[model samples]
Target chain A: MIIPYLELAISFLRVSLSAYGGGIAAISLIRHEVVVIRGWLSVEEFIRVVTLAEMTPGPLIVNTATFIGFRLAGVPGSLVATTAVLSPALLLLTALMLAARRLESRGQFRVRIQDAVKPAVLALMLMAIISFGRNAVTNLSTALIAALALAVLLVSRRKVHPVLVVIAGGIAGLFLL
Target chain B: MFVVFFRTGLLTFGGGYSILPVLHYELVDSRRWLSEQNYTDIVSKATAIPGAVSVNTAFLCGRVLRGKKGSATAVLGMAIPSVTTMILIAAYLFEYVHHPGVQRFMKGAAAAVAAQITYGVWLYARSAVRSVWVVLATAPLFAGAFFLGLHPLLLVATALVVGGPFVYRKAKLKAATSSPESEYSELME
Candidate 1:
């Protein structure tokens, strides 16, 4: 069990490098790792955690990793998972911080690199919405819940917090779902 | 500085790229701790880093505010809430989340979240779908992902190989024509 856990941690670390392209795009990669390959989480649980990450007050990837970690191996699991995702990133960031002052022409490269990633990010987002949408919108009740939530979000102009909207969806589920 | 990022972390629901406005308000508008250019530079560079974009942003902001310790402090402040919240959920709600009543809750929550994700993707599209070719290009990518279940890295690699040269050439053009001042100005708005 421990060995498998370590392997899982290593996999998480590997995934950290590919965590670029702004995060929503990374969701497809994460979903693939969690649900498709590892089978650590079912689609429903993964979706729940993604929403829960939104309700929590941190980065989505960090929250999702921590939550999934906790669900898998308890506190230690969460720690390992979070550390796996964060440590590589933090190290790389620290090195860049030290080096950035000397490096000229970073801004142009940054723009081009981001631009190069854009189409892929767009495609990944498409994959995430279609695949996750299929799993999430399993029935009419769920469909209505989604439509209502989208409407509420649209109507509110995003002034209403997403947490409130999600919690409200839970309440709506009590009767409707 | 730690207190600032701590507060930002607590306020950062839906974190990824969402923390930018909050950070901007705190650092540039409210406290004036950093200038507008400082904020823009931090954000653009941060997203390019390998970590969670928010964490990278927070860490760099902290580093800018103080030094190495500041970066560590900022990241710690940002992460504490997430770690604690997840632990509590694991210890308590893990079981109940799957209960019949809560399963219904989960269903609804999932739907709402999925809808929210759809809205987010649209926003990303507005920025990313620069040309009609991008739209045409996605069909094969979609089929690969949906039907063949190819890994995201493969698709991403494909996108890089296919789309990179055009954008890179455009960047060269901009570098030739425009001042560095104008490049970041687009982001300021």
Candidate 2:
């Protein structure tokens, strides 16, 4: 029991420390850790894990961590894994906040860097959309469902919450497509 | 403050920067806890860092708004929903999730997720510094990421280096911008 827990801690600590460019980008790194290194999950199982992560709330990386941890042990395993994944990040964040504070008098220096990199971040999001679209919208029927869902989201002035749209999409798929 | 982050975490279905619109709505538009500019600044920086972008945003925004305690509250609030929900799913739904009907339902959910993600990115792009140069950079980035398979990190580093002139020009114009923060001050502070 302790051995599994220890493995969980070490594996996810390594993941959090090394998985740069979070979310979908971390998927490959996570796959390497769980699938290749530990042989905890097969390739097919790993794909399911990622899909499950995508469907849930919160950070993709964290969701994946929780699921894998629970599978490894139980509820306690999940907590340990989540904490391990977050530990390194929290420390780094503290250091970063302090540095940002020291640069306070620099006058929009931080802001300018943000502006400079904003487009690249936008580009990354664009890639996420593209990659997600390819995986999710496979057939013409699924494509139509996605388009209608998008239409509802856009037409409602975004008054309709995305979760509702997703639920509707699921129901629509059950009967219609 | 905790409530704000809690709701954002609860609603961010696809995570990553999907929380962008939720945060904007909660912090910037509805409450005004953050200015429009400040939100984008936090978001952009969050994306570039090593940690989870949403968690990083929660921490930075919390630090800016209140203090360390605020950051603690915000990060905890941000984490709770995902941890509990995933745990529940793992214990119960993990077994049944592979069923055909459930899989179909999840598949449909994925389609809507793609659409919602499109909306999220659009919101951020609009609020970000919109300029011809940004527009110019976006197209090639898409091509490079798709065709050349460039890493997102590499792309961001390239953007920062290429956009180095902007930072340099501002420093030159200001006539004595702070020479990057010292390692000592960053640590000792």
The candidate 1 chain B region of ten consecutive residues with least summed lDDT is B119-128
Determine the TM-score of chain B of model 1: 0.59
Label model 1 with its docking quality class. acceptable
My TM-score estimates for the predictions, one after another, are: 0.67, 0.86
Please write out the lDDT profile of model 1 over residues B68-111, one tens digit for every residue: 88889989988887788778876776655556786676667667
Q: How displaced is residue B52 in candidate 1, in Å?
A: 5.7
For model 2 the local lDDT of residue A137 reads 96
Q: Model 2 over residues B10-85: C-alpha lDDT tens digits?
A: 7777777666666766787667888877787788877766658788889889988888898889888998999999
In terms of lDDT, the poorest run of 10 residues in model 1 chain A is A101-110
> What TM-score describes the B chain of model 2?
0.81
- Model 1 lDDT per residue over A85-156, tens place: 888888987776556444434555334445665555566656757766786789899899989987876676
| lDDT (C-alpha, whole model) for all candidates | 0.71, 0.78
Name the 10 consecutive residues with the lowest summed lDDT in model 2 chain B.
B180-189
Tell me the TM-score of model 2.
Answer: 0.86
Deviation in Å, model 2, residue B7 alpha carbon: 3.1
